[model samples]
Target chain A: MDMATMNKLMECATFANCYPRDVVFRQGDPATHFYSVLSGYVRLFRQNSEGREADIRVCGPGDSFADELIFGGDTYEYHAQAADKAMLARYDINRVRNAAQADDGMLARAIAGSLAGQLQETMDCIANDRLNTAVQRVALYLLEQAEGQESPASFRLAFQKSLLAGKLGLAPEALSRAFATLKGLGVHVHGRIIEIEDMDALRAL
Target chain B: MDMATMNKLMECATFANCYPRDVVFRQGDPATHFYSVLSGYVRLFRQNSEGREADIRVCGPGDSFADELIFGGDTYEYHAQAADKAMLARYDINRVRNAAQADDGMLARAIAGSLAGQLQETMDCIANDRLNTAVQRVALYLLEQAEGQESPASFRLAFQKSLLAGKLGLAPEALSRAFATLKGLGVHVHGRIIEIEDMDALRAL
Candidate 1:
């Protein structure tokens, strides 16, 4: 987005503060505004009748959630919760829609870009779930987390191991086994911190 | 879309004819345009290295595909093939983007609506894959197919039985077994045609 559009969006935005673990919205809530994370994290998810939850996506700073609802029906189909004490900017859907309409395609293109990126991510998730083994999925996820870093770099897990397991469509014990298997590629996991001793070998998986 | 917007869109559209089983576009092709099925059917899918294929969606007349590529990088992420002899209208992405930008928020809203609908469908697919049993999934699929019909109605399968099985994330044999099990609920399957003798009983599943 250009500075002009960004400024216009920010100008119409309202701010909200949420404590850690705050429920931002629940499934079936009216979707009147689209939210951007100004600080901290938000987790999007859905629960089955058995009350088992599936983690959809985690949004950090500058990332937005539920923007798809802007174009669809008036209600949310999933739940969102603040993963940290966070500040968010909520843009009224109508205002944003009107602004995009008035623009010379920049805002519309941006909106399209956001949706496209999200759709691609979801598609990739589905593909991985269907095509990859549990160990391969865990290894690939580590590589993704270590993306853009120098070889042999390390990082902390963004969310809990159990939640990560949910996102990867694996049982927690299965994720533990995957981590144990990844040790062969020099992935060292000590609680939330992980160190990649051989990034290339991990990538080879 | 209104008549004016529809006329504008059609003015920028080019037509393509496809034979049965024709490859409309392959994974990784440049996504220069989004396509609408003017007649017949198109199948969107992904294939693994083992040559196994997963059916993503089947688009019939009036439906669109590849809209997700409009917002992100200019490359197709999935394969599209004609399920039947088909006619498609391709709209230049840049022209559509510009026209949407100039509209009174209606065109942009329409585009957003399309993306949102696709996203929701994909999300639901994921949820169903993760949460439902094979029998439940097949039963739910039948209910979805029977949607908009009066009770005890019948409808022909839109695609082949194998394709329907793939869409429901079941093996061909498993799908057959599911069909057999569903007979108890008064779902009579005779090859491609299915008769729902008791819609309420199927829904009760």
Candidate 2:
């Protein structure tokens, strides 16, 4: 994309703030808009028919979400939510694409690249989430969230467990059961903070 | 999408014939191209970690597949296979997008309409095949049966739970558990003399 095309696209941007846990866009919602994080974090995920959501990634400052829908669908194939207080530059998909319309090569490359990225994310979700049980999925999620924390054995749930339950393909009750099961296995959960009393035990679950 | 832009987009098209059961592209392949069916059918699906293939939807004449990844990611989200002998128009994602770059509105709207269509079909199949649980499957199975049955309130088990379980992609034990769950839902299950006491409740599932 040339500087002029890029600039024209930028001019169409609008700014907004999304509080933590606020929904940005849902899987299957029209892919009419995309966003770039100026500050804070965004959660990207896909939800299944059973209302199970699987995390795709977390986008932070300088990161973008749902931009690829321009190359792929009328609706988003995934869901996006503000993971933390966030300021975002929202771009209308058509407006940006229109801005780049003058350069066919730029548009083509963008489409291919964006679509490729979307595809991989979705395929990863299916491959990872499909074969696993609720317990297994929840366990994996706990382990992932715990990683990189100051205390590797403890961390805060990024979002409410209600949200986590949907993402993990579990009913709220099922999630509670999973927590209980993990607790029995030596993981501790009190509200949002989770502690791995026995990392090995948690992993063994 | 104006005729000029549409015509220009069509100019970039190329043709290929894919045979029945041929792997058009596997899920996770680079989203370099998408296909429009000219004749026959195309099967789209996602695979689980265990190599189980869950079908999303099948593309028939005039239907297109894989076009939505343009806005989303770097790879194909699902696998596409020729279900029957098919002649298709294959569009390189970048090439097609480039053709529309001269008119961004055309590109965006074309994308929105095409992608929106693709997702609405067989999405549930994807949910069922890729992410739904045994209980959910049973619920879905019961619903599906109700639709096919002349008298939905009461119907005989098609075969046995063992066979039914396999058909619905559940193991025998998992199938039993599913039945137990459904039983709690007020669905009557006495060795295949199945009776759905509340149709709306079953539909709610």
Q: Please, what is the whole-model Cα lDDT of each candidate in the order they appear?
A: 0.82, 0.68
Candidate number with greatest TM-score: 1
Candidate 1: deviation at residue A151, Å? 4.8
Model 1 alpha-carbon drift over 4 Å, by segment:
A101-106, A149-153, B97-107, B148-151
Clashes of 1: 0
Candidate 2, superposed: residue stretches over 4 Å from native: A1-6, A20-84, A91-131, A139-157, A180-205, B1-20, B28-33, B68-77, B92-205
TM values, all candidates: 0.89, 0.56
lDDT of 2 by residue, A1-205 (tens): 4676566667878999999889988787777888989998887666765676655556778666666555445878777888779999999988766654555445444544444444444444444454567787788888887776443388888667766775565678999988887777777887899988666665665
Per-candidate clash tally: 0, 27
lDDT tens readout by residue for model 1, B106-162:
666567677777777777777777777787898888888889998788999887887
CAPRI category for model 1: acceptable
Name the top DockQ candidate. 1
Chain A TM-scores, per candidate, are 0.89, 0.68
lDDT tens readout by residue for model 1, A1-205: 8898788788769999999889999988988888999898888888876687777777889788888876657888888998878899998988887777677656766776787677777777776776678998898899899999987889999878876887887889999999989887788998899999988897666
Tell me what fraction of the real C-alpha contacts between chains A and B each candidate also makes. 0.39, 0.07
